[model samples]
Target: MTRTARPRHYLMCRPTHFEVSYAINPWMDPSKPVDTDLAVAQWERLHALYGELGHRVDLIDPLPGLPDMVYAANGATVVDGKVLGARFRNAERAAEGPAYLDWFRDQGFTTRDPEHVNEGEGDLLLTAGHVLAGRGFRSVTAGHAEAQEFFGRPVVGLELVDPRFYHLDTALSVLDADRDEIMYYPAAFSPGSRAVLARLFPDALLVDEADAEVFGLNAVSDGLHVILPEAATGLAARLRERGFQPIGMDLSELLKGGGSVKCCTLEIRAAA
Candidate 1:
């Protein structure tokens, strides 16, 4: 069966208020200051690239105190116009949860305030007809259950074993949902989660530790075109061999905050 192509809509927040004020995650170092100007320049180029690719791009106003708000994918997970709001684990990002919820509500989505802590799409990734949720560093098992109930879809809970790969987006990426194809790092996940991945996506592309460390798995794909980090040369080559066009873009500035292409963009899906 031939899959129909749909133009993807993404929600992105400008790095206008971006900075590493505190060290909430392992990747963060408050002592090391961020180059705000360079961050904005790179982000603008990415935004322009999305527009050039014929995808719709939307923006959310960046609030002053929410530095990590630039990682828009953590805002919410929207499936079929129903939004599952994020309940951030850290007090530093807690306020961002409601801010994102309000944006979704204003955009006409039926938003569900999560009872448990989940970092939106950052932890709850959709592939095929299931929601693969990650739990360990940031999200809880309860959030996975809530996602399953809220989306009315099967939620496969995966445990992230590595501290650097705190979010699922950091270790795994769904390349082609229709084909059930994914790219991931096995060591980042628990033994049980790895088994689940093997059973479900046996033909999955596995990235090496070098590529995974560069946030290679944190990519965004429009089925045909993949937007990934330039540093992941090996993964990029594998994508090309698999018949997908891999477009490499440098997001080095955002790497300091533990984010890349996928982190800066949130997919907005239409109702089924």
Candidate 2:
């Protein structure tokens, strides 16, 4: 496939049909349950915000048994025109892949399925030649390696220790690709993980612990855009200072289920 510049399209799952309204995220303790209506409202806000930002959002049909399917982490990605679906490690979330695969096949996507267990769009980040794959919790070491081989690109595994940063998008988000700058939270990432990140993003900025708790370390869309939790006003202001247009929305419901901006959305294809 010849390389042609493609626009980066960000995708977010609408919570209207999400399963697991109980706020039962695999990473979060089962003791803390979620309220259904609040969850719905939170997802609504997020959807509205993303829609206003001009990103193409393809909402999948929510599987009856998987409430977290709205997270869309198990979906497929379109890289160099080939569609790849995940073989997930989380038993409860595995169902998401087939649903997305059905959609991709219907859309005429040339699909590739990984033999090893791999998290979907959540664990992979593509930057030209480098593909940073996340390990620990929802994703595994073997999955990361399989991802590299599957994409036929060099993959760097970022080790995440804390359950809070179960996905790379949770504690590590790319801020600027040209400068190799990222916004990250050290507490959520392991020492070795941070070292790996430093190498990828030598001028990375650390988001405060308090901000990280509020999902402030998530990705900065396109170079000039940022999507953040509405609760983190201070951090939003800081982003504005950096010449970024901050778009804030409520993701409290997703927080109850241990997900935020990056988890709820997957930028499947983007313009370099």
TM-score of each: 0.97, 0.86
**What residue pairs are clashing in model 1?**
none
lDDT score, candidate 1: 0.91
**Alpha-carbon deviation at 168 in model 1, angstroms:** 0.2
**Span of 10 residues, lowest total lDDT, candidate 2:** 1-10
Pairs that clash in candidate 2 = 6-271, 7-271, 8-270, 8-271, 19-67, 20-67
lDDT of 1 by residue, 1-272 (tens): 23334579999999998888888778889889799999999999899999988999999999999999999999999998899999999999999999999998998889999999999989988988689999999999999999899889999999999999999999999988877889999999999999999999999999999999999999999888889999999999988888888889988888889899999999998897
Question: Per-residue lDDT for 199 in model 1?
Answer: 94
User: Which portions of model 2 show Cα errors greater than 4 Å?
Assistant: 1-7, 19-33, 270-272
Q: What is the C-alpha RMSD of each candidate to the true structure, in Å?
A: 1.4, 4.3
Best by TM-score: 1
Q: In model 1, how many backbone clashes occur?
A: 0
Model 1 weakest 10-residue run by lDDT: 1-10
